[model samples]
Target: PRFKSKKATRQGFKTDRAKIIKGKLRLDKPHGIKNWYDIRMSGDKLLTGELKVVSICRENGKYWASLPFEIEVANKAKTNRVTAVDVNVGHINYTEGKINTLPDNLKRSYKRIKHYQRMLARKSVINGKRATKSNNYVKTRAKLQRDYRKVANIQHDIMQKFTTQLVEEYDKIVIEDLQVKQMQMTHVAPKGLQRSMFGYFRQILSYKCDWNGKKLILADKYYPSTQRCSKCGHIKTGADKVGLNGNLKHGTKHNEYICYECGSVMDRDENAVYNLLALIN
Candidate 1:
């Protein structure tokens, strides 16, 4: 890959001529470079098997190295357990009647990022007419970049843990094939839906399930999981499907789902998960 002169732009290269020694990554010196570098890796787990490739990159004022190893992934033992999940803007609902929300720390990180972004914007406006950037402006920009990286790391960590847990505990997993792009483009899309990482969550869940020998079922995008009653198999149609404010009409609360046919009432997200689970069960 081509390297940019500026530090802000991402630059990286891949090399297979590298090995780990005593927890340090040793790389061969390239042309015109005199010294070999032994970079200490972060993880505690011992890397085994043939190291296929190592990607070295400078990102967000930090150097990152990722080594991919060729190894066999053994299948997880079967438990015959199955579950369905409904991923929403801020939380996830499960067929097991559990709800998990984005952690407080992550939310705070997001808030901080927004604050830093606004600060950076102000600094940029101040620097726009100047020939050189002020030290304070440069510092603020760096801080904003760091916050962006921090939020990404936190999100990735949470997603990794959640996907790994699901793959290990369940033999079959069900999730909606959400039209996330369409939702994002729509004028009246749900609040926070544009910022939600539904696509990333689905991507990770899919690969984890594949790696661990688990079955992942994607309910059709048009499936009426949200509009269907979990207890009575009744499907809400027309304006009754969703209220004028984009909620179930049968319930006063935003997340409450009520069956008109049978008068069954439950949390909307849980009801959706149940409807998704019914496909495989």
Candidate 2:
């Protein structure tokens, strides 16, 4: 209530309001809450059933509340459908291994972040022996922070929607448990996009599947999904590819899997999805 008494920057408090009638939230009688919280919420999902906990949080000078609720619902995911997802830099490949590139909106976010970062670096140069943070410096720093936050928010928002669709559409979802950290350290796909997005998608899909009563299976990290043939179960070797420098170039056109058994030459991601799905089948 009294958030500005001290030098407090931000503040938020939660109340266990049992009697939530319509838009008004009422606390227990013992708390002496004469007036109820007139809270209004708008979203695609209609709030129903019982409210578990109401957590109020203040972020970036904004106050928000998270209301976790329980609902009585039927099966959300279609039991007959199953899909394997292949996370990549350019796009997300699902089902038959088709690629969908990143949206222009998300690409713009990255550009803006880089612009703000350059501005922030210029601002940093003003700091010398007698130099302190000027008004312009603080303003520029805040701008950079906002840009970073925008990029993070946009990535999460897109992945959240994508993961939700996957979970709700399919009864079973399978994805590779990628060694992202190791891949990053090893300088794999340095210029490709979505290197940072795989973990985000996986984390969202995992809990969302549990909440919606769907199944999420993680293929082995060492599983040769791309190298194995989906049709005839042929394992392509490095020496098989023509003009390959060393091992087969992963995440590129050269990564194409031409099955020696069935002679099925398909896109690497598409072949991988089929191999991943075969794990559970």
Candidate 3:
């Protein structure tokens, strides 16, 4: 066998009888397994309805089970509160006239991850004289993989909390249609900075909003959100002459936006937020 005989990638099994008693998922008389086996249910909500099918699977050195059930949810009451989120390179701009810096837990431990990765790479290759690697090589490789796993876990936890907070508070959420994948490919920004988990954040927002009965909107990519004035119906454009009137202007740091016609200065991201919110209401 290519792999160890005792290990298998996946398995298919089914059971019609299962129940949750005393905060554990119990299965009765599973073939080639113990009778009435139960696993403790922690950090999981008990889905409503009869337990139809339970599929247990393993992924990324972890065990997970998929429980499917049917439930009915009534429509949620509409609210007047609306939120607009504009994603940026360093931070995010949202409605209510506030700016929030994007959170990246992985950045805090990047050096440690790099250290382990370096150790792994240096020990993985066979030397000119040595035909095989030593046990230390395997150990270094495992350490590197574990470090990456830690990063993933941290990212997932942060995104889950942030998305839940948004879903619980706001009924209507609007965000810009950012081209994250394109940004990563172009290498226009720093490699670490561009590889944000914005896609994962949006994916969570989608399903959480649906489950909680909320509305999410993505504005058009080329909507000229930054160029348009939030207060007035004015568009900013390049100057026709050196002393041309109604020429668009911005701060040198690119932190603020200046309207050409209305002559109002505001945070760049905040300006974008207002433009996006104006689309729906």
TM-score of 2: 0.72
User: lDDT tens digits, residues 1-281, model 1?
Assistant: 34655653677878888888888898876677766678877777878887988888987557788888888889999999999989887777785555344578767877887887787677667767451267776676677778778767877787788788888889999999998888877676454675457999899998888888899999998899998998889898886775424554444666877777998878788889889999996
True-vs-predicted CA distance for residue 102, candidate 1, Å: 2.4
Off by over 4 Å in 1: 1-8, 30-35, 42-44, 97-101, 129-132, 188-191, 243-251
TM-score of each: 0.89, 0.72, 0.69
Which candidate, 1 or 3, would have the higher TM-score against the true structure?
Answer: 1
lDDT of 1: 0.78
Give stretches of model 2 more than 4 Å off: 1-65, 70-73, 96-101, 128-132, 190-196, 239-255, 259-263
Q: Which stretches in model 3 have alpha-carbon errors above 4 Å?
A: 1-22, 26-37, 43-75, 97-105, 125-134, 190-194, 233-251
Best by TM-score: 1
> TM-score for model 3?
0.69
Model 2, 42-154: lDDT tens digits are 66555677887677656554566767778875658466799998877767788844544456765776687688677766666766532225766556556665666676776
lDDT of each: 0.78, 0.69, 0.65
Name every residue pair that clashes in candidate 3.
none
Total backbone collisions for each predicted model: 0, 0, 0
lDDT of 3 at 184: 75
Candidate 2: the clashing residue pairs are none
